[model samples]
Target: MPGAPFLRGDRVDLRTVTPEDYDFLLEHGNDPAIRHGAPAPTPVTREDLANFVEDDDESVQFLACHGETPVGFVFLFDVDPWRDHAELGCWIAPNEQGEGYATEAAALCLDHAFGDRGLHKVVARVFEHNDASMAVLDKLGFQQEGRLREQDYVRGQHHDTLLFGLLAEEFEV
Candidate 1:
């Protein structure tokens, strides 16, 4: 969405998430698809997001919009200035899944994190069962660094996580 001019694309629009995005955040947070990614209650109130976006955040968040409509959110975090490390994470609206939007948006974010932000490495840890996300990260050249056993407990069951990473020098595109 951000690659082209005016932050526009067929699948999404990349914009900053504002305090006004509370409604969208709440709706998406309760979404089953998003819950599968990283389950948490979306705060309906403005204060809910204030804790994250208030100051000069080392991390960055972007709201993914489709046309004039808001659809999802993406973020880059775990920014370590000393070691120059960061992590890439994203989530698409439930209705927008399996449409390649995530891949495209992620690529842009990764580029900015490593190329523009001067980060040396970007990492991601996805649930082992999330094949689609795993594929997207793989296509982006993120290698499987390790497998974390029982790293998460979600929906009343324990699941393993796959730690994936991509280095700045390793990016081909």
Candidate 2:
């Protein structure tokens, strides 16, 4: 069973990641549609997932759940308290994509990031081909701050990576 939510939204609640979620995460992380956008598209193992869940002190990771069902994952990683900023990342299950879940979940995390954590800014990196994620970031008021040319080699081709940023004062909802 999932634990109590650390952050709640109208349709989604961001809860602490637990050991029980490994299988769900493993399946999604290894999915071709999902892995292709990842920085390293290498297969993830149980050990890798475990390490990610347990060893990342600089991240605030959560399972995005609807009611009692997990639908996606969201996190604020590479948190730099000294700099008052962090990188936001999220992924929805393929079956649950295009339903606004990613946007809702990410908004919830941004609330925590800027409100609770008192962050000045939050940034995200999206692959050039990830139109969905780019749309999500756009809806969340993230501006395209920069772009790296051919930054990631996905599948058999190189893709540009877009950098987006949102300031705490500029966030709404």
Candidate 3:
């Protein structure tokens, strides 16, 4: 469990990551299904996750939960208060996928980004092979901006990264 959820959605709640959440991330974050689109160079250890939650200040991260059970996490990276933009990243636990948890969590975060954070735009980069992630972005009204051909080499194969963006004026929430 987290200290207290900073935001809540229909199906999920967003909380700042806690040390206790590291084990959950270790188990689910390393799943091949979850890591396929978002590559992890090596298996992440507890210490690394601890550092990420405790030390990294460049990004804002939240763990999503349905009740007391963790469902996933959402992130706003490279946030530029001056530019009024940020890069978004999110993942659903393998067991928790396909239940709209990610979508719900994303909606909550996007609301925060455009409303509370006062960001003008938010961006996302998705692996070419992750159609599900693309669908989530589409459902959230993000427009396809561009593609970086063969931008990432993961799991012994090169993959393209598709960029998507949503402006605050375009966001429904």
Candidate 4:
């Protein structure tokens, strides 16, 4: 279990992700607009995404909601307890891309990371072409850490990834 209870913000409420949410996760991740923002553009099969959702091994998967509607999913991976570092990823519905929901949800995640989880750092990777994602990480006080060159090959072309990380000591929260 996560060290704290579910977190919520003005625009979004975050709860533990469940198998029931698998269909939404799979469908949203495959949305054309959403796929374009991600570095990997492969077709996300329902079974594949379900498998991914099934592996919430660290109790880190979160389903973000807008009131009663499911917007999308977010989670942390690559947890190193000794190092207190993990990577976070999130996706909001194409229609819900703006209005600061992403930032709100991300802020809640960071609180869970630093406040409850006792983590020292949380990282995120955004494609160079995704300005909105970069802004959300920036608002959450994450700093650019490094660049992974040609880290992702999608549709016969390679794309770069920008890594951003937030340290507990560095966050204003």
Candidate 5:
């Protein structure tokens, strides 16, 4: 079972990731649909996933849970404390995508980022074809700052990656 939440919201709670959650992470990492928007879509092994969970020193990762069941994950990576910014990344399970879990979970992380961490900005990247992620970023008040044309090759074709940013002052609860 997952541990208690580190950040709580109305509908979801963000909990620190644990070894028990490795299977959940592995399942999502290998799902093509889930991996579609990822910059690196290569197949991942259990050992590889374990390494990510263990060796991450520059990122803060959390599991989004609804009543103890993990529904998704949200994280701040590429954190540059000197610059007061970090990159946000998240994914919800296929069956759980339409709900508000992603938004709420991300909001909780943003709260931590801009509030507790005293960050100046948070950025996110999404593939052009990822409408869901775009919507989520939009809801979180991330402005589309720029785009990298044909930056990622997925499923045989190249797709542009949209860069979005949210200033600390621009974020809303």
Candidate 6:
């Protein structure tokens, strides 16, 4: 707990997602609140997640930790080396929300995306109704770029998908 973190932050560390962490993903990742931004419709099986962790070559993913405890996840996906861009995605456990973990992890991912990965830009698509996620992006200096009208239907309601983008030059830290 006193040593260096995998990717150190003020309040959290970002480390590679391991096979053992899939169990944690199964439990926290499927919580209804956490699923609000997830692309998949249903909870995934361990096998499905295993394949995801193994087959995913375009994304840079990390399991968020606080002193060795897994609290959430962050990812930069849909990476296009030629295009110099990627899509950002992240989530904190329901119990861990509001502690600033998501923000720090996201910022770290952006650092890796821009500093380490040398990407020109990063983008995110969030649900219109999810103000919390939108606020997180806003705090990270992402600009609202566009919106897709009623692009998602969940809980018997249609919601627009808001697109946010941040250029490498726009990154603050």
Which candidate number has the best TM-score? 2
What pairs collide in candidate 4?
none
lDDT of 3 by residue, 1-173 (tens): 66588997877999988888888888988888888978575888998887777777757889999988888989898899999999999999988889998888998999999999999999999998899999999999999999999888887888899999999999997
**Residue 62's lDDT in candidate 1:** 76
Report the C-alpha displacement of residue 32, candidate 1, in angstroms: 2.5
State which candidate, 2 or 4, has the greater TM-score.
2
TM-score list, all predictions: 0.86, 0.96, 0.95, 0.89, 0.95, 0.94
Q: Which residue pairs in model 1 clash with each other?
A: 13-65
Task: Give the C-alpha miss distance for residue 88 in model 6, angstroms.
Answer: 0.5
Q: Model 6, which residues run further than 4 Å from truth?
A: 1-5
Local distance difference test, candidate 5: 0.89
Worst 10-residue stretch by lDDT in candidate 2?
33-42
Per-candidate local distance difference test: 0.76, 0.91, 0.89, 0.79, 0.89, 0.87
Ranking by TM-score: 2, 5, 3, 6, 4, 1
By summed lDDT, the worst window of 10 consecutive residues in model 1 runs over 1-10
**Candidate 2 Cα lDDT to native:** 0.91
Clashes of each: 1, 0, 0, 0, 0, 0
For 30-72, candidate 1 gives per-residue lDDT tens digits of 6777878763534235565666656536788777766756666
Predicted model with the maximum lDDT: 2
Is 4 or 5 the stronger prediction by TM-score?
A: 5
Candidate 2 segments exceeding 4 Å error: none
Model 4 clash count equals 0
